[model samples]
Target: MGIRLCIGSVNPSKVRGVVSAFQSYFPVSDVRAVKVETGLPPQPIGLDVIVRGAELRARLAMSGDCDFSTGVEAGFYRFGSTYFDVEAAYVVSRELGESLGFSPSFPVPPWFVDEILSGRFRELEEIVDSLYKTENIGEKTGFISLLTRHVVVRSELSRLATLMALTKILNRELYEKGALR
Candidate 1:
């Protein structure tokens, strides 16, 4: 059977990044994505809240009998005077004999904190989409878009960082189960 993995979100940018990430593993079948509640509060922060949010969606996606599932939650964590926000993903595989639980991974770059504090990219995905034009969605394409264009493109970084975290999760899970080459 093909990799029939399901994404826990229906956001277009998320769908594109995740599908691109998993394409190498499961190219034949499409990356099936379903809309599910992340259970995250209006303003999510802290590692516990983020992990819980991801777990909620991961379990929901897995319950649908998918071979694998991916869930992403973006939030900001404050460390003393600085605040760092990033998109994190939790990947789960159903092939494990027992519940392998969930793997948490994310990209933490120096500028990520500045962007969050600068209030440019309140929502990382939206900022990135504005820069990359990945989805061509006109929700934030107006003249009043409030995201920083300094440093790398926000959308590319956000999506690339998220994809990297997912890739790491996939590699870690596969290696732990001796499925990795």
Candidate 2:
């Protein structure tokens, strides 16, 4: 058996993205997934906030019986007049470097702010669900869902990028320790 990995999320799309990203560095046998709660306010507004959120999930994932655990948290922050969303990823393992934090933020469409702050979306997932019509956020967006079709959602990609960054950090740690022969 290889390193048992766990992700602190039940979202399959997220799991697929993160698993794919890490697979490039480690074999599938070494990775795994698990679900954990992330206590974060809606549209987290800064790196520190989101990092804390990621850490919370990571710690929860690591608490389980696994070799390693990963936590990914995504949220939006405002810079000047523009708003950007970022994903923060955390990897935890007893054998690995205690902890590492990285944030990957990208600018999103402006109109999203109004729709987001309208009290209709309490979390990033809610926004995505509303947009995709896959998971409704209380049916608050009657015709708005149609408009979402025109809007592009980059949140998932940003989250995946954060996961990739974390994987890079972990791989480097493994290589330095001769764990990645």
- Local accuracy of candidate 2 as per-residue lDDT tens digits, 63-139: 54576677776667789999776667777766655454454455666777777778765665566566665563222
C-alpha TM-scores of all predictions = 0.60, 0.69
Q: How many backbone clashes does candidate 1 have?
A: 1
TM-score of 1: 0.60
True lDDT of residue 49, candidate 1: 78
Residue 44 error, candidate 1, Å = 0.8
Per-structure clash totals for the candidates: 1, 0
RMSD of 2: 5.8
The superposed Cα distance between candidate 1 and the true structure at residue 96, in angstroms, equals 4.9
Highest-scoring model, lDDT = 2
Clash pairs of candidate 2? none
In lDDT terms, how accurate is model 2? 0.61
Steric clash pairs (candidate 1): 128-155
